[model samples]
Target: MDEDTTLLALSAIAHRSRLAIFRLLVAVGPRGLPAKEISAQLGIVPSSLSFHLKDMSRANLVSRSREGTFIYYSAALDAIHGAIDFLTENCLAGAAGNPSSR
Candidate 1:
C-alpha cells in the first residue's frame, strides 16, 4: 500500500470501536458476520456500528456484501496485510539474529 492508503487504514483502526470491530472481524475469519450479529456481539449500538463500518469501508479496511436482506462484512485482508507490511517492511533489515525479528 502507498503512504496515503496506509495512513487511511491506520487512522480508521485508531478509534476504539473501530479497532474492536476490526479485531473481531479478523478473529471471525473471511466468512464474516451479519451486521446485526456484529453489533450484538460487540455490544455496539446498531447506528454506531453502521457509521464505523462505513468509515472502515471507505478506508478499504472492510468490505460488505448483501445476501438476501442482510449485509455481511469482512476484513479486507489484502489491505490489512498491506498496511502491516508497510509498517514492518524494513524492520531489522540486516539484523539476522535480532530478537525483535522473531
Candidate 2:
C-alpha cells in the first residue's frame, strides 16, 4: 500500500468503535454481517454505525454489498493484509542482534 492509503486505513481503524467493527467483520469472514446485525451486536445506533461504515469504506478497509434490502459489510481482507505487509515490510532490519534467535 502507498503511504496515503496506509494512513487512511490506519486512521479509519484508529477509533475504538471502528476497530471493534473491523474485528467483528474479520471474524465473520467474507460472508459478512448485515448493517442491522452489526449495529445490534456492537450496541451501536444505526446512524452512528452508518457513519463508521462510510469512513471505513472510504479508507478501503471495508466493503459492502446489498442483498434484498439488507446491506452486508465485510472487512476488506486484501487491503488489511496489504496494510500489515506495509507496516512490517522491513521489520527488525537493523536490530542490535537476532532477537528471534536469542
Candidate 3:
C-alpha cells in the first residue's frame, strides 16, 4: 500500500469505536455481521456506527454487502495485510545481527 492509503487505513481504526468495530468484524471472520448486531455488541448508536462504517469502507478496511434488508460488514483482509506489510517493510528480521530475529 502507498503512504496515502496506509494513512487512511491507519486513521480509520484510530478511534475507540472504529477499532472495536474492526476487531469485531475480524473476529467474526468473512461471514461478517449486520449493522444492528455490531451496534448492539459495541454499544454504539446507529448513526455513529454508520459513520464509522463509511470511514472504514472508504479506507478499504471493511467491506459491506446487502443481505435482505440488512447490511453485513466484513474486515477486508487484503487491505489489512497491505497495511501490515507497509508498516513492517523496513523490519528485516532474518537479516544477520537483527535484534528482532530469534
The C-alpha TM-scores of every prediction are: 0.85, 0.88, 0.87
lDDT of each: 0.90, 0.89, 0.91
Under the 3 Å rule for N, CA and C atoms, how many clashes does model 3 have? 0
Q: After superposition on all CA atoms, how large is the RMSD of candidate 3?
A: 2.8
Q: Go through the candidates in order and give the C-alpha RMSD of each one to the true structure.
A: 3.0, 2.9, 2.8
Report the number of clashing residue pairs per model.
0, 0, 0
Candidate with best TM-score: 2
Give the Cα-based TM-score of candidate 2 against the true structure. Answer: 0.88
Between candidates 2 and 3, the one scoring higher on lDDT is: 3
lDDT of 3 at 71: 86
lDDT value, residue 54 of candidate 1: 96
Candidate 1: residue 17 lDDT (0-100): 97
Q: Pairs clashing in candidate 2? A: none
Q: Which pairs clash inside model 1?
A: none
Q: Rank the candidates by TM-score, best first.
A: 2, 3, 1
Over 4 Å off in model 2, which ranges? 90-92, 95-102
